[model samples]
Structures are given as structure tokens and as C-alpha cells.
Target: MNHLISRAGLGILVAVAVVAGAWARSGSGSVTAQAVLTGLLLGGVYALVAMGLTLIFGVLDIVNFAHGAFMTLGMYATALLATGAGLNPYLSLLVSVPLLFGLGYAVQRHLVSRTMGGSLAAQLLLTLGIAMLLENALLLAFSGDTRTVAVSFDTPLRVLGAVADLSRVLAFAGAMGLAGAVWLLLTRTRLGTAIRAVAANPEGASLVGLDVRRLHALTFAAGTACAGAAGTLVTPLVTVEPTAGELFNIIGFVVVVLGGLGSVPGAVAGGLIVGLTEQLGGIYLPGQSPLLAVFAVFVLVLLWRPQGLFGRPA
Candidate 1:
């Protein structure tokens, strides 16, 4: 009875907070609901990117600093394919996903693979080099012009007076589905077992007859594919540029750390929490938003829970 009372009290507190905030903002319940949904929808995309980052970092233990660059590459690929080649943005997945996957496989197999168990400098420098190469390559090709893919077909959805573009909503749904699938894969498949095993203990996994090299390639490829999908999903909402991934990469790293190195659920939770916090803080805090707003939380998380919300205890 005591536990139940405590839980009920917490729930009531949260409800009161929500109601008070809504009353302060507009005194409209529908409007508050709208605000909440808006945050949730956008949070989905952030979660998707965080999931991919967690997967790569958690399993392979290689911090692909270039993960965001891959996402940007996907955005660019989809935009170019959609506008230049006259293909649907969604349909461009066929081209973008494979290209990103191939790039990931090649990079890991040739560069990251060689750096395994080597000096930390090698791993860092390799990924850093890849990031630099991608940024420069994009600058040279796109000339710093910001471009966004327009959804030629869209049906706007209005939920409780809050306007949401159909594309963004679809992207949000896709992200959720993909994240769920990833979690399922991580927990319920042979390949997932091998991947997790390799992540936990590479040498032991190999001793048990798992092919470390192949699994590594697959992990790299899968991570890239997640980034690619995220890029494609968000491209319509934002610009496609060379340095676009920089900010995303930073957030991705934070979300992964906050979620716990390789915990998919943790990633999703962290991403949503970060995303909503950013959105709400941006609105309420005035002049302090996004990067700056989340900085405090970032530091607190690191100091209080170094392993992140769900990260394994060190």
C-alpha cells in the first residue's frame, strides 16, 4: 500500500505539472496535447539516429565518429536521386541504403577492421579521417549550397489544432518501427546473439566459433543502414549539406551515452527525453535551447550516471 501510494502520488505530481504548464502557456487542453504530440513526433527521428549509434558503439566497440556523416550522405543521396533522377524520396531508399551500407562495410573492413585492438589513436584517427574526407567531398560536390528534398506528395494531418506535415509524421512512425525492430533483433535472433556476444567478449565469441570479422562487417553495415534511413527520413524536414551531420553526430553520441552504450531501449528513451527536453526548453527557457539547453543534463548524466540511464555498470 505504501508503494502504491508513492506511485500514485508521483503520477499525480506529473499530471499537475503538465496541467500547470498548459495553463501557463495557453489554458487550452487541446493545445497542450498538441504540443506534447509535436515533441513526440520529432523525438522519433532523434531516437532512430541514437539507436544506430548505440548499435555500432555498443556491439563493435568502434566509435564511428563518422556516423553523422553517413546520415548526411543518405540525405544527400536521397535528395539527389529524388530531384535529379526523378525518383520518389521514399523510393530512393533502394539506392541510398545500399550505398551507405557498402561504404560502411568498406570503411570497417579496410580501415576500422585493421585498427582493432591497435592503439586508440589509430581508431580515432581513422574515423576522424573518414569524417574529414566526407565533409570535404560533400563541400566540393555541393559547394555549400543548402538543399532540401521536397515531398511532392504530402497530406497534412491536424491533430488537436497542432499541424504536422504528413512526411514528418511518416518519418516518425518509420523511426519508431525501425527502432522496435532493432530492439527485437538485438534480443531475439541468432545473429543478434552473436553480435551481442562479440560485443561483450570478442575473443570468447571467436573461441566459440563465431566469425568476428564477418560479424563486424555486418554490424558496421547495419549501423550505416540505420543512419541512412534516418537521413532519408529527416531530409525533407531539414537541409542537405556537407557539415549538416556534425550537429547530429554530436547528439547521436550523447544519446548513445545517455541511453547506455549499446542498449537499444536506452537509446530510444534517451533520444526521446533529450528531444522533448530540447523542444520544451527552447520554448520556455528563451535564448537557451538545443545544444546549450541540454548541456547541463549532459554533464549531470555523466557525473551521476557515467554508464548512462541503461548502460552496463563498469
Candidate 2:
């Protein structure tokens, strides 16, 4: 009951912040409505990114610093396919997801698995090295140039008297759909049960005949595939650059911590909270970076509820 109330309270606070920020921005009812709607839509994408990060951490107990680099790879892959093969950006997901999945599985099986029982520093350094390598490879291939997927659905849609880009709405819808699918997989499927069992106790799972290493690899691959899907979804909305993944990496980490280190649902809630903070901060702080506001909220959340809004007390 307390957890439910806390969640509800957090939601209310975000709602109030959105309303107050919009009202203060221009005192225009339409503008305020637009900001709120835009914030919510963008929040969905953030949730998708954070969900990938949280899943890996929850299951594997490893901080995947290269997660965003994988996302960059996906962005490039989608861009190349969409532009070179004349495929629709969304259609390219068929290639991007599997490609990233294979890459992730190979990396975990060959590199990360070697450091499983070693010091945390080894794992961190290894993942960090992988991130650097992927980013630089992208730089060499794409030359730091910003690219975007050209899509025909660039028109704006009106909702509650507020205008929203159709692409963003579609991204939001896709993110939500994917999140739902993941939740169902985790809760309803046998594979998901094995993954969760491995997460809970690798030794126990191994004793029970589950291949712990395989599960770990599979979980990591699934997480990376989510990043791939996110890359494809955002290709039309943002400029795709090699370094674009860095910002997402930072945001994903923040969401993971803010949501609770290993809580999937908490990650979703944290993403929405961060989205609201960014939009509201943009309005209230006018000239400052919106991330400053996000960091501020992050600090307060850490101080007040270190386990996160939905996390149980340790």
C-alpha cells in the first residue's frame, strides 16, 4: 500500500511540475498543453532506452557502458539500410535487431564471460573499452557526420489543441508496445522464467540444469536488441551521430539509478520523471541546459529515497 501511494504521489508531483512549468512558460493554454504532450511522448522513448539498461543490470549484475555504443551501431545500421537499400527506416529493424543481438551475444560469450568472477573493475574496464572501440569504429565509418533517416511521415498531428510530430507519436507508441511485450515475456514465458531464475541465483539455476552462461548471453543480447530497436525508432526524429549514444548512455544510467538499480518497472517510471523534469526545466530555466534540472532532481531523489520511488528499502 505504501509503495502504491508513493508511486501515485510521484506521478502527481510530475503532473504538477508539468502544469506549473507550462503555465509559467507563456501563460498560453495551448502552449502549456503542447509541452505536456511533447514531454509525455518523449518520455516513452526514454523508458525504452532505460528498460534495456535496467534489464541487463538486473539479470547480469553488470553495468553495460557499451549499451549506448550498441545503440549507435543500430542507428548507423538503420541509416545505411534505409538510405542504401531504399528500405523504410522501420523495416530496417528486421536487420538491426538481429545484427545487434548477435554482436551482443558474441561479446558476452567471448569477452564478458571471461571476467564474470573477477573484480568489478575488470568488467567495467572491459565494457568501457568496448564502448570506446565501437564509438571510434563508427567515427571511422561515418566520419562524425550527422545523418538521419528520411521518412515520409514528417507531418504534425494535433491532439487536445496541441501539435505533435507524427514520428514522435509513433516512436512513443512503439516504445510502449515494446515495453509491454517485454513485460509479458518476463512474466509469462518459460524463457523469461529461466532468465529470472538465473538472475536470482546463477548457482541454483545451474544446479537446476539451466545454462547460466547461455541465459546471461541471451539476456545481454535481448537488451542490446532493445537498443537497436530504439535506434531505429529515433532515426527519423533526431540527428544520428557517432556521439549521439553518449547522451543516451548518461540518461540511461540516470534512469537506472533513479528507478532502482535493478527494477524494470522503476526504470519506466524514472524515464517519465526525467522526461517531465527536462521539459519543465526547459520552460522554467529558459537559458540553462535542461539537464541541469534533471541532475538536480536526480540528486534530490538519491538523497531522499536512495532505493528509488518504487524500490524496496534494502
Candidate 3:
């Protein structure tokens, strides 16, 4: 009961802050619209990445530090297909998604499965090591050169009085669709029900004839596949390099926490909030780093609800 009240209080506070901020910047209507649109598009991608992280954490209780690395691999895969075979960047998704899914399933089955029920430190270290290995391997193979997929359709279009590239629009649309699909899979499918059962209580799930270990692997694979798809989605918007996923790693964690670990809807809302905060912060602060606002909001939310906005009280 107290948790509910506290959450409501925080929500009200946040709402007030947003209204106040908007009122303060009411004069810059066009600029505000541009920021809102841009933030929303960027937030969609962030939500895609966070959805995977949240799923793994919610179900397997694994803090997958290597998620961004998986995304990096996806970016490289898409770029390679585009540059080498002259495939359209979007067409590369058919290959990259499955490739990532297989890689994730293999890694979970052979590697990550060993550390189940172990120390949190062990899991973190193992995932961190995985991240490092993938990054270094990519560095060796690609020599740290930034790569891009050539696309001729990236023409700028006016959207609600704000200009945006076609690629960004498409990326945003694709991400939202994928995120929704994941949501439906979780809420409507047998696999999702089994996964949720395991997440709720592994021992009970096992007693009920469910294969917990297999479910864990499946969840992890799904999570990694999300990272990979996100990477492919953003290939046209960002540079592909060995360390490209590093920043996203940070942002993913932030979004995961902001949305409440394990809550899909929370992740989506948090992504939009973080995205808007970043864009509007630039406009309001003028010279400060946009991330400063994101962190500020993060800290405030943590202070108010450490379990995250959508997370239940411990």
C-alpha cells in the first residue's frame, strides 16, 4: 500500500515537473515539437534494447552486460551484408536476426547455463568478460574502423514542422512494431506463459514439469536477439564499430532500471521519458550535456522509487 502511494506521489511530481518545463519553453513551439519528435524516435530504439535486457533480468535474473556487444555484432552483420553483397540495409534484417538468435541460443546453452544459481558476482563477471571478448574480437577483425551501410533513400522529410531522415522514421516504426510483437508474445503465447512461470518461481515451475534450464536459455537467447535486432535497426542511423555498443550498454541499463527491471511496459514508458528528457534538456539547459538530464531524472526516480517507476516494492 505504501509502495503504491509513493509511486503515485512520484508520478505526480514528475508530471508537475514536465508541465512546468513545458510552460517555461512554451515560446519555442517549433523547437519543442522537433525535440519531442526526435526524442520519441530515439526512444523507440532505446526501448527495443531495454526490452531484451529487462526480459533476461526478469526471467533468468541474469545481468547481461554483454547485451550491447550482441547489438554490435548485429550492426556488423548488417553492414557486412549491405557492403559486401550489395543488399539493402533493411533486407539484411532477415539474416542478422536469425544469425543473432542462433548465436544467443548457443551461448546460453553452452556458456551462460553453467553459472545458474551462482553468485551475482560470478554472473556479472562472466557477462562482462563476454562483452570484452566480443569487443576485442570485433576490434581485431574490423580494426576499429567505423563502417556505414550506404542507403540512397535517407532523404529528409518534414514531419510536424520538424525535419527528419527517412531512415530514422523507418527505424522508429520498425522498432515499435518489434517491441509490440514481443509484448504480444509474452502476453499471448504458450512459450511466454512458460517463461513467465519460470520467472515467477523457478522451483515451482520445475515441479510442474517445466524445463527451467531450457526456459532460461530461451529467455537469454530472446534477450540477445532483441539486442541484435536493435543493432540492425540503428545501423543506418549510427556508425558501426567494435565498441559501438558500449554507450548503448549504459543507456540500456538506464532504461531497464528506469522502467523497473522485468517490466516490459515500464521499459517502453521509460524509454520515451529518457528520450524526451535528453532532447528537451538540450533545449532548456543550452550548454549542458543532454545525458546530464537523463542522469538527473534517473537519480530522482531512484531516490523516490529504487525499484523503478514500474517495479514493485521489495
Q: Which prediction has the highest TM-score against the true structure?
A: 2
TM-scores of all models?
0.90, 0.95, 0.93
For candidate 2, lDDT tens digit of each residue in 1-314?
A: 88698879878986887687679676778767776788788888888888888889888888889988998888889889888888888888899889999999999999999989788888889999999999999899879889878787579899999998888999889888988888888889999999999888999999999999999999999898888888888888889998888888888888888999778888888887788778777777889998998888888888998888777788
Give the Å shift of residue 214 in candidate 2: 0.5
Clashes of each: 0, 0, 0
lDDT per residue as tens, model 3, 89-193:
888888888888888888889888899899999989999999999999999988989998767777998998888889988888988998999999999999999
N/CA/C clash count, model 2 = 0
Q: What is the lDDT of candidate 3?
A: 0.89
Best by lDDT: 3
| Preferred candidate (lDDT higher): 1 or 3 | 3
Q: Write the per-residue lDDT of candidate 1 for residues 237-307, one digit (tens) a residue.
A: 88888988887788888788788888888888778767765655554565765567566778888999889
In model 1, which regions exceed 4 Å deviation?
Answer: 1-34
The CA lDDT at 296 in model 1 is 71
Question: What order do candidates take by lDDT, descending?
Answer: 3, 2, 1
